[model samples]
Target: MSSQQSIRQQYGTVQANALKLDEEKAKQSVDALNTDLANAYVLYHQLRKHHWNVDGAEYDQLHDWFGDAAEDAETAADEMAERVAALGGVPVSGPAALESHATVDFEGEDVYDARTSLENDLETYGDVIEAVREHVTVAENLGDYATSEVLRDHLAELEADADDLRGFLADDTLVLESAMH
Candidate 1:
């Protein structure tokens, strides 16, 4: 019962799949999915942090919004990871690896007001959406229609979330000492 003997596939190597997709093309799609997976996790952690620290006049609404966005990020990550495996590549794991592959940087420990938090979240969502859009194109070029479809759906959801965050930021009516005053 040796650990070495129990090992199966290795990371960064694409194995043969029943889907009949070219190994080279699958590798390309896998790389794209892995990157998206990393981005999704970064978004998830940042959103969770905001969810925990959200306060001020919009505390309840922002808290719920951040929590839901975090959940969506988690779900997207899971789907991307599974897709990576289906493409015959190992899904990237570990914080270090995820951070290395991530296109968006994680928002650190500093807790800001709800408006600022929403602003940061919107920026991160925009980055994720952009990356997802590129990956969708990559999947399409590689003939990985399933992967393209998955990323397309996530892209729509991310855009919707970003729009919601924008709405929250737009309503800055809670400010004191108005410019008109």
Candidate 2:
């Protein structure tokens, strides 16, 4: 490990009841939330990838929508990590760590078909939702109400994202004839 790594690892020990939470339970909640943070990071980048590369007659609209979703993911990740820190735990910060810790995987092609792209995005959202729900219970069981509340809100947001994507996919009134011109 580098000197910086040694320093951070050495003094990074979490203290109990720093945030008025049970130290052990807070640490447990933080551990679970670190995984949530990492997965959110993965989903943020994946959403951005689709936002930047998706192609279709509706490229502009989808790109804009995905960009907003990516921003939301980024915010969620940052907030989750901040909560971990607030709970006196170290958030997983390295890309490799984040990737290994993430439950969601990136599977969309560099170029994507519209419905497939939407479906892939929904899958990513769904994966995060599942993880979020699991970790929310962890937080609640630990009496980490702040963390639990944040995660509950995140769950709602993810569901809205999925519902939005599913709605677009279900819309059959799309007309692409004019775009072929």
lDDT of 1 by residue, 1-181 (tens): 5666755898889998878999999999999999999999999999999988877766788889889989998998999899888888999998999999999998888988776778888899989898999999999988899999999989988999999988887846665755324
TM-score for each candidate, following the candidate numbering: 0.92, 0.88
- The numbered model that scores best in TM-score is 1
- Residue 39 miss distance in model 1 (angstroms): 0.2
The regions of model 1 sitting more than 4 angstroms off are 1-5, 172-181
lDDT of 1 at 178: 57
What is each predicted model's overall lDDT from 0 to 1? Answer: 0.89, 0.83
lDDT value for candidate 1? 0.89
Model 1 poorest 10 in a row by lDDT: 172-181
C-alpha positional error of residue 126 in candidate 2 after TM-score superposition, expressed in Å = 0.9
Q: What is every candidate's alpha-carbon RMSD to the true fold?
A: 2.8, 2.6
Tell how far residue 59 is off in model 2, in angstroms: 1.5
